[model samples]
Target: MNTTPGTRWDVIVVGAGAGGMSTAIFAARNGARVLVIDAAPEEGGALHLATGQLSAAGTRLQRSKGIEDTPESHLADIVRISKDTADRELVWLAVSNAAATIDWLLDDLAMPVLPEHPVRGQNHEHYSQDRYYWGPDLGRSILAAVRAPFRELIDSGAVTARFGTEVVGLVQDPEAQGGRVTGVVTADGEEHHGTNVVLATGGYNADPALFEKMNGVPAYADASYRFARGAGHRLGVDAGGYTRNHDLYLCSFGSVLEHDDFPAPVLCRPVHWPEMRMPWEIYVNVEGRRFVAEDEPSVDVREHALLRQTDLRRYIVFDGRMLREAPPMIPGWSADDVRAHAGRHPMFHVADDLRTLAASAGIDPDNLVATVEEYNANRDGEDPLGRRFRPLPLAEAPFYAIRVQGMSITSTAGLAVDAGLRVVRPDGTAVPGLYALGELLGSGAFMGNSFCGGMLATPAMTFGRLLGTGILSW
Candidate 1:
């Protein structure tokens, strides 16, 4: 579909990712003329890099497998994992419609999820039931599923997609009309008028300035899509929409960075799963105190524990004997790589003594020595942090420490939206014609301070489908 310069559209969606595509497809299927504008050179914004993990309860796949599940169960799991900080109404909406979203992909779009999927997820906190899902090609598989129908809609002249176009600002009605959104203005100064505008511009994880502004902490790693610079966030703010959820910022535990640079690109992530590799290294904070059990089973506990530390940074401490004898601490790295990178890499350090090792890693020397001594002394008894698997002592010479920091793959803060997906002001008044879906509304909206599996992408796709199907009145 081609767009004429001044033609009015029924819906204008910014960002051509999972949520934006879903919104355009559903809206067009409902007989609306939809125009989608994205800043990327091509569509599939973050999906190209996303893991595409999703979760839903009581879907046809679950039923066929005889797996007992329900939306109520899904809602309960998310609230429990999020510690009740998640917006209840938004969680309810996402979970309620999640099954339908998954079914649409599987049954309608004929997308193939792994046959043995719907399992408890491994990366984040595990759901009680087997509700997690992913495709063989990760996020690209999900994009293929959405893009097929979306292209069909485009060919039918119901949806028009313009890539390499950025929505710089939203057009709003007069102050007399409560400043309702009217359309959007592109970076090229072209104004596109529409009855409804959906901001699916994703998150600001890629922008260090906005990441620190919204999250109250500096971004530690550059792991998100580069185009996710929070354009929709700015557009929503310009249209009188407020943002929230800064207090709910959460970070993943460990990522090996390419260098010592702040917001450094990730080289590889370390595998800290106890089941995969038994405890050989202990994690210590800047104060040189053990913050969490080295072999803690729950990833959520480890991540939350890291949040309380200074700057959300920690060091993995191990001695030469353990480094040589224990299973590889960093995933995909040979034991030789660990030894080689220790003294050479900016993120890794090694010294002949405990105090020297502590000094090299910016840890308090006295406290680090005491912490290591305490662990060595308690080898036969229950560990102070209740660490059950104390396989080796850190008494060997030539100690090593690998600096690690908390990092997030998604932005936690975003434009505030009501239950109907309408962007709202700080005073709680809706900005008519402006709706937000997906990461533009923030992962904190549904996932809270915890990393809830499938909450981000699932809700983005679900709300996009709902909004396109006329769930909100224009």
Candidate 2:
């Protein structure tokens, strides 16, 4: 493409996810001209599908509850969860600004939290204090608060938003003194130029090839925003940014996929946590044997164990008796719904006998039989291998199996950046005028190696606001 006349703006944010939109709002509000671009027709990227869990520390609620949590405690929790693998400085920055960020959302951004108010942790883990909350509709609620402000800025001509234009490449000002990025070239050969660019394009969870190359593991599922395709990541790399935290890539626990396309998991209703689904059901690997405690308290512990196992494919096997007696494992499902779910979904496989079920599902029949027998025999014992929840024996006939695969919607590995959110190269030099936030910066930065409640949505909102309003303030 020919070098077009470089257009100038104070900030150009790539991708219209929570991060990009949040940044655009702040940047525009801060008396700066901003343009937000996304490949999709709509602005909310993966927010449509996300559960929208957010975490913060030292909030109004926390203070009212008399809960003592410093930014250091928040950082400590993240580091401990990540086993000291995350960027400490960035973690500190995020945790330190968390309360102010949340306050901004609640007061100025029109964010509305649930009535429960400041629950420590309901869906994921417990924070040191009660400072976690989600909007009524989760992703939609946050988007509702953010979208209008962004659109208002665009309407007033302070912020320009161009959707359906995918950023294809980064344009560096070679003749410029600093290695500044002058513009971004779209797929359709249009160049949207700016003085500073924020890469809020989200992660590579949708691109298996890029994910495998960067993360060193096969992209388990195409579960994120398809447009997110790591456009920002590729652009960052092209502009000489170095990626890190690839080793920290982690997968969500037990998704029973419906088809090749991901986010397509038949049921992703957090079957493992809270030990909510009765443990009469045992998870078996391709070898047809139980490996770890089915009801382990930590999703991370179960996930790490699954990664160590062969194929990372497991079958949840439960007897008819338990199926009839226990509460529906899946939400909004009657027993008939559960029965139909087995045959209707691709991941779900069923059979009348253990032998036939194993053969049909491609698991070893003998091993499955042994596993079931061992589980049944030792279930009542003081201590049983692979038994943490004191689940009933799997002795009834007509056993059922649902195939669960490890998957992740957020990319954990991402471009390395400093506390300022500037894209940094491997040599530790800043990629001038380039910044990254949200999933494009990877979840590993905030959540660490663990999925600590609201790291995904919250940090994106926080960092995007901070970068646009705070760091980039001139």
Candidate 3:
């Protein structure tokens, strides 16, 4: 059975992602009469593709593991990690409610986290507290955990979900302040009226043009959910709510692409984490000059260095001996597999000499040879970049180079919202019935110019819980 086209609802959620599902679930449980519409064929938006990491302080699991943590500590760590660039009000709101969100998943929903979860940090910078958490299956595990409860609400006729349907526009009441968004317009030319509209539509990373427009860089890697195409951004901005934090855009460290394109599929992710595997390779830009120290501990420092490079590209140079002697650069593949990929793939180049290798990999050959010479000269002495781990110099034949591109899979710019999550104007007046959450609020709103561990997924659900529980009213 379909919901009547013009029927009124207490809350109309635009995208059925983590945030949207949470809002619909809680609102329906609270007897709010919710409607969830998504462009995907089923629910679970970015969670289907995200890392599924969650960070919260002071959870029951933490206490059980003798981990003493608090929301204040979490907030302080985020502030410190993000360099005080994150939206303080929004970050505070998420951290304060994050523990409850995690508890609801663990205790109420029985979602299983890793046995040694609540780790200090993983790939990114370390948080002061052991608050980062994720499941065995990553994001999919969280998707499975939320699906059952949300489906129950749908089955009980409390919440209605319309999948594979896109929200084309927002219905605004011209007579109200800031043209109050009263409902949403679907692609089928139907208007679903509601008291409040929540724009949980993910981000614009999948849309290359939009991503570049917002981030000042091309979407180099095709690693985001395909349906996140800025529908919410359009709806919110059209409804008079402006987007913010575009200036806070930051790229990921680096990943090898399958092909040379504006937005290419990610072929493989090299393990650049020094803590996990010490680097036996040197990273250089297209100009064949070393930018950041290869042993740079901070992921943020390496990522920002890549951001400064032309086309956000880096070339990881090493030798055959390093492939066999050092830990596998990629998690699983071994020395033989690395040799197979070198000449076969465009991103990977192998040659007998540095000049020839640089030519194949599109790096400056003269600069490459000179850079290697300088690097090898400093092998027994102090390094120029202050690199601590200088195990071996690049003297072996069959030299290799892996070209990696730095890119962000999440949007940095998002629609502006006030304390209540209501989409607001520049003057600070709320668009009466409009609310925005999830990636539509942008990653920068929570993580700022840096990638704070689990900030995206955790805050998304926390905001949804906050919005659905006693925030929206008929």
Winner by TM-score: 3
TM-score of each: 0.97, 0.93, 0.98
lDDT of each: 0.89, 0.77, 0.90
The candidate with the higher TM-score, 1 or 2, is 1
List model 2 lDDT by residue over 1-474, tens digit each: 433344477888898888899888888888877878789998999888787877888887667767776777887877777777777877777778788778777777778988777876765556666778789898888888888887888888888888888888888986675578877888888787788888998888777788878777776665677776777787888888977777776666667676755335445542676445646588889999787787777767887778766666788888788789877776666767767866566666677888988887778999999988887777677445545565577777667887888767778888788777889888888888888888877877777676777777878888888887867432
Sorted by TM-score (best first), the order is 3, 1, 2
Error of 1 at 83 (Å): 0.9
Q: Give the TM-score of candidate 2.
A: 0.93
Could you tell which candidate, 1 or 3, scores higher by TM-score? 3
Clashing pairs in 1: none
Give the local distance difference test score of model 1.
0.89
lDDT of 1 by residue, 173-273 (tens): 76746887888888888888888899999999889999999999998888899899999899889888889999999888878788867789988777788
Instruction: State how far residue 35 of model 1 sits from its true place (Å).
Output: 0.4
Clashes of each: 0, 2, 0
lDDT of 3 by residue, 383-426 (tens): 89888898999999999999988888889999999878989888
Superposed Cα deviation of residue 171, candidate 2 (Å):
1.9
